[model samples]
Target chain A: MWDKRSDMIVHEQDPFNAEPTPQVLAESDITPVDAFYSRNHGPIPAITADDWRLDVSGRVERPHVFNLDEIRQRFTTHAVTATLQCAGNRRAGLIDVRPIPGEDPWGSGAVSTAEWRGARLADILDAVGAEDDPDLHVAFTGPDVSEVATPPQPYGSSIDIAKARSGEVLLAWGMNCQPLPRIHGGPVRIVVPGYIGARSVKWVTAITVIDAPTDNYFQASAYRILAPDADPGAAGPGDGISLSTLPLNCDVLTHSDGDRVPAGPVTVGGYAQPGNGRRIERVDVSTDGGTTWNQAELDLPYGPWAWCRWTHTLCARPGPLSLVIRAFDDTATTQPETPAAVWNPKGYLNNSWPRMTLHVT
Target chain B: MWDKRSDMIVHEQDPFNAEPTPQVLAESDITPVDAFYSRNHGPIPAITADDWRLDVSGRVERPHVFNLDEIRQRFTTHAVTATLQCAGNRRAGLIDVRPIPGEDPWGSGAVSTAEWRGARLADILDAVGAEDDPDLHVAFTGPDVSEVATPPQPYGSSIDIAKARSGEVLLAWGMNCQPLPRIHGGPVRIVVPGYIGARSVKWVTAITVIDAPTDNYFQASAYRILAPDADPGAAGPGDGISLSTLPLNCDVLTHSDGDRVPAGPVTVGGYAQPGNGRRIERVDVSTDGGTTWNQAELDLPYGPWAWCRWTHTLCARPGPLSLVIRAFDDTATTQPETPAAVWNPKGYLNNSWPRMTLHVT
Candidate 1:
């Protein structure tokens, strides 16, 4: 097992919400299991590797219960470096606008990059003889239950069957060349690259081909963007804005808030990630409240799902200042200039220009 | 005791943090005292109006500890309708960006309006006699303690000495013909109209004239705009950006989110508040991602501190849509298109184009 670091942020203890310190995360392209932020909804089930079995049953011509060894033997393994982020990763930014009574105020540590090795989900569906019609979905269920829910229900989510045929979704068992840690859904977890971490169900135990999305608590009520005053009990599936793709986001790891620097040159750096499979096109840095900006040097992405880190150096003036950073994705989308511009309820998916104000002493 | 309404949002217990219901807040020109939000930092100190005395302590030629009636008799009473909004209002939008780990996700409801009646702060300072140098501040300390602090420090804030002399600063004792409620600094409170609510210290007990801002926890650390990741413990007074003027903000209160309505013409209305003393020059409403905007009708403001409400009617087609509204202040500063653009760690002053997503089913 790769040694997992214990120094990152721990937003909540139960369900184990943790984010890697930006310093540690920015040091390497591949995030170690320990450094990876864990966005868990329920307690980690202690399923032994040998005892764990993935049951593929619903709407299949041939249902098969595949164990760890059987799963590896049945399909070829593929590896990809992907960045996983909690949909609520930057959620604290939204809550900063308006306080949401009962919720976690997450920090920038909720994302991590890792090399994942797994069997393609399409291969498993093909072997199971999928009989689902078009325009349907594949639902995955796990034993985890998000304590954030009103009644505290088991964890579940779904993706379009068309997405299943895309050959990107995987049933992963290895992370960064090590067996996935139990905190990261070791034994087996579904990896839905480019989508939010919620869609990538961890500790996945079953898959069902259905005509619609899963009716699980998270899928039905949790992820959607509800009104700030909207009651969770009144809404149902497909009733509000459902989050699917990740938003364009960037974080400055090299610098922290309230940091003091000499009134001269200093280097600033961070990682940039884009939605779906879009690559980051350019990054701009501004010290004068977006009045002017300088382009930063960007590294090519290792994979479509992984983040591209960037760096820049600028002369500082001795005064209180805000260092602003914004990134544009390949889709020609740029980060919003202000967090208040894209203010939303449930505090989901904020990719505005990130600003860190400090003093040049 | 004045009757406090039950419909407003209550953010914390013990030291209460509450805000009015948006709909109720926008209902009348002058908000009822019961509907006014109460933002308390510490336990309500037990004191009677007859026993309470304001201690005029630091750097005063004529130091006078005056009781409530004595203080009232020494100055002339004036009334003004002003809106007091917490600096952390709309913080939920910032928390939505990334979790701030340990903080509140404040909603837009963290603001309220009232007709505050009181003697001018200048009048009190005149009676106390003053000794001040240039580049100095007038610090106000209250019996209230902000629970956000670890040791529960008393609430304190400071404004420029020149600002203290602005005549707009009021040492208020009455609200809507009733003596200030105990929950709202009953005996007396400082109403710095147009500034963030933090500067309007409630339950005022002392005033200190100093060469710099107050060194108290709330003054030196809490209200300033520090970097999102900045440690609250490391900052001192004047180390970060200090907020004096309130930012321009608008809210849609008439139509709630997730509202079910027929696919036809509908009226939308709400309030628009300008930053500082600027008036709302215009309000633009967009039904289609701001491709086309229709100006809404605006009402003249009653006072500089009170909100100016507006209304607009438009036809809607049956579909999922976002009704976007943005306001421009007299200074030509239009609302930012996104919150991430202006995102800060503390989640203060989000004046973004508010968008409400709804379904016309």
Candidate 2:
């Protein structure tokens, strides 16, 4: 596994958390399979496509079990090109503001886009005779157990039924038109576009339709945004805002922090993703510490759920320079100017203005 | 009309644009029909229910005309309690930052919630055999014509077919359980809950399914967000972002700009709205210019599309004091801190932190 992802930046060894370099992501529209980010809460479970089984139960009228072949044969296949982002993407900025111990110090590489193909969760719900109730939730649980919880338990998360039945959510088994790899949930996983990546359970084994959000630690307590001073250790279930869809975010991917560049015309670019179905309307690049701004050209997104790649050519002078990028979604919502404005104890959803300093020669 | 709305703060007399007092809005969840804000573009059309006709055509399998009685009898009636907000609801804040000529300086009272009873647009689209295409748009036109456009054309706008068939869009005929008043689009109107209020065309005369967004000035250019320095005079059709789903916003509604208050303990409250289907997660009240914040208690919204009422008690000293409020939607998005951060030439979507100063004695 280490040899295969040698080109990526490995953050942890046991759970195999790794991400591709920023230039690798900036170079392509659809992220390459090996270069795609891998974020796991537990050791990768060993399971073959033929031996994997999916149990659909709970409020569903016809509770049934299906092998991998049955899932592929019974439901119609649909493809969606969506960008999945970890809620902790760009968490390094928050950690720099203050100490966020025990959290991954992500640095703008935990997000990537891919062409996902699979059976729609809505179709599966329809096959199982699921009722259309907004109050209900579709919970997904995986076989991999992680000690991240106080007591070891299978990793689980859930999305509201309306999102589950939106027809865009999928139980995907293929990535970039290739068979899903073992490291990325080979048999099957849930792909909830527009939501934070944690909700898209990898190695998904059992799906249950419940009346409320799943009581799993990830769904009920862990991935929430608490007050800045609130102690996460003392929080109970549903303590803070349960993060779902993402907010407008953009990052400068070409130049790493403290990079030295020749003082002349240089290209600066990055990727921007607007939450839910909103489109990236405009991207403003500020070379003079946000006192002056130039609009960057945005490439049309592959789909509503995909990210837009933006580029701009800036004329640099001989000295130190500050570069900041912010995006406005179609809804006219822009990002906060600094990470401190959005910093939390968990260091999640750091959608502040992405900045980098370049020493010009 | 003025007699009926004596309690409202009338902005325009001819087209009858007016809004209620903020205290009036804060006092109730469901705005009384008489106190509801009335925003109009042109002179109200005098059409009785018996003679009013709805012509449904354009890109549909069947084109038909329906009378009010036919509309009431042919489809199932649904009730949705939704907040309708003007894109210019908080334009006053932007205007205070800079001069925004030729625009109404609206305060925070331009948004209100009411229970609307109507036929679902999805049902209407189904009845007309409209295809479910994401690229297509459903255009709506009304008999009232506004002179705001250079050519003085009838007010018109369009929403994408996905939003049109989302089951939340309605052809509303009732407001707060009463027959819609003439000034408020008497016989029938298109009620797009989550969109900018301009898209909800009143006195609706025609509904057309089109291949692209409507060419009407409102849809094509007027409601768009242009660059700060971009000359509006030189802008063409399809320029800037066409305003649609609202951004997350909150407003302090209990006191006016210069109200004097007793020192010691005072209660401050406001309304917060999360865009589209998202709910208001948390509201923060700052008594000393955002340096410190106290979480305001949020009241349950009437529906997903409704606004959440929030309030907080503050201890004040005898001096001039500034209060600022910001809201976090379930998506973890918050308002910008200052009006200058979001000021545009058009003075739309000033969702910056809502602030007011008072002389505490």
Candidate 3:
């Protein structure tokens, strides 16, 4: 018999499982929540508030445990609306060349912006009496676990010693003015605003200061983006890089090929975010290849972790047109010219310029 | 500690839980999956195929029970890709005038599309032997038990004898070319292609043909959308009307105040779906309120149960502009002119002309 719990409301499509096909972003600067793509590894957990707790241990001078109420009351809270893009957000575009092995073959839904509020991790570290140890990596673990045949380390990741101490990291307790729901990490969870979400562990169970990087499976094996030149099928974990922060470049693509719009004028828009406190200085759109470029309108100012929306209007001409958009950060890091040049085995961190073929009739 | 399953991916938003605040649907076609919205009452369940079954009983000439394997072997399979929209898909737009009791405050994500496949319910009914009864209602029961203080009726819904006999209903065993995932009613389920998804029961365990309509809570009280003139908050078991078939109407509204586009050109877009067997005959859009209208381009052919994507382009001109899109069905039933005249207490069906304010520079 179908379980009542499984009596789910069905929609027109598998809303969560579809691959991201390139489409122009809405004209508005802030993406409506439904339009934001989702990136998840499994089903949303059903968490009960009564059973939740946050444990703080390891290299701390005072190891203490806090429930949801205590964590909310003992710390000063702040909010920041930032864009959280999965390191592998647009992996499908790369997979079109060759299949990549791993979890979600996500399209673009992996990126989204939400107002986050919580105690800064740096503040919590200070409260716990952290020591200045160069070798220490602040490791965060979640209640979520996956079985490994080889007794794999628990699924968890860590931030570098400096970033953890920057006082910018937050132990988020709320979103959009509401207590965080269990689906999005309820009670208390970590929010490293400018970093990839992998390090922002949900359902956080513990914070441990270790002398070395986390040995967890999620730390050592997964969440690592292979180098651009790495072999597709070769596996040795060679020089694979762990994604500790967001990428510096922004890649936005639009598709109008089969879309029918009258010939005269058209507007295309999307959002871009840079990693490591880098702000987007400008966005350029090219109707042809990069041979020619035009400045697009920046819809909003750069926020600490939020993506900036950009738009451009093009006079319609009757013909097949190629649309390309690339953004540069204040640090001068621009999106790579093409995906082929930056294609990697795991299809991670694909910040290549997005190319769209459209008919502007 | 967090359950390992907590990491299960959340692919989309609950559409009815919020409103169209910043206006996400651009061009009215292509509902982004993450933004496509959802309406579910409980946490997704964990179901295993080995323990699943589909039972057929009641007023049949030959009552029979089929396990997952037996159901798979006994029926010839077919597939259909259709759109399933919840009755409450756009209820948020109506909350300002009159509020409904106990219903979820959903925004716009309650609709989605997917390819569904299974043996025809007609075939199964014929296999088990259909009695020569003309007034029987086919009842479907699922395995979920309610936890509310009120004793839960076994979750079930019914279709009319004519609908059951029409040979269009299906006992869906697959979705999008894959075995139905447990969360989506794995081993076997139902697919009432042109009907509301709530009628397409998941985790189906039994099917019974009774002389009277289903007495289950869902069929008796839950799914009905009261008439616009009905009293607000009057939907109780005694006062509530049974939710049978959905009305054939389309409602698509825009949230922006008048904003002008450059005088060269502009594009108009929105989504349209006929409630039942009704096919969308034509979609007309107007840049000047209801004064003048232009025919729009329809994307795909009308399926027995799916939404069509429609778009139109307007020659831009300088003025305060209001864009309204209306749909005509095979039956020639058009959407209401305004929400106020069609608003209902239960907020069931609110298919009115979608109006968007825009300006042409």
Task: Kindly list the per-residue Cα lDDT of model 2 for residues B1-361, writing each as its tens digit.
Answer: 4225567888888778888999899889998887778888788898898989999999889898989898899999999999999999989888988888878888888998989899998998889888667799999999988998757999999999999999889999998898887777878999999899999899899999999999998999888888776778888889888899898899988887788999988898889999887778889887777756779999998889889999898888999879888899877888777777677778898888888998899
* Model 3 chain A lowest lDDT segment of ten: A1-10
Indicate the residue-level lDDT of A39 in model 2. Answer: 89
Write one digit per residue (lDDT tens) for candidate 3, span B1-361: 1111222223333311222322454433433333333344433445678787667888888898788777778778877766666676656656654666656655544566667788888888888887878888899988765432134655678887778876567788777677876555666777786676678777889999888878776776666644334454445553434554555544443334565467766666656786566577667776666544566787784366767767677677687677776675542334545544334566655555666677666
TM-score-sorted candidate list, best first: 2, 1, 3
lDDT of 3: 0.63
Please tell me how candidate 1 rates in CAPRI terms: incorrect
Model 2 DockQ class? medium
lDDT of 3 by residue, A218-285 (tens): 66666665543455345343235556667644555344335655688788777778666657766777
Candidate 2 lDDT (Cα, whole model)? 0.88
Off by over 4 Å in 3: A1-37, A147-154, A227-239, A251-257, B1-361
- What order do candidates take by DockQ, descending? 2, 1, 3
Instruction: Please report how far candidate 2 places residue B198 from its true position, in Å.
Output: 0.6
Better of 2 and 3 by lDDT: 2
Error of 2 at A35 (Å): 3.3
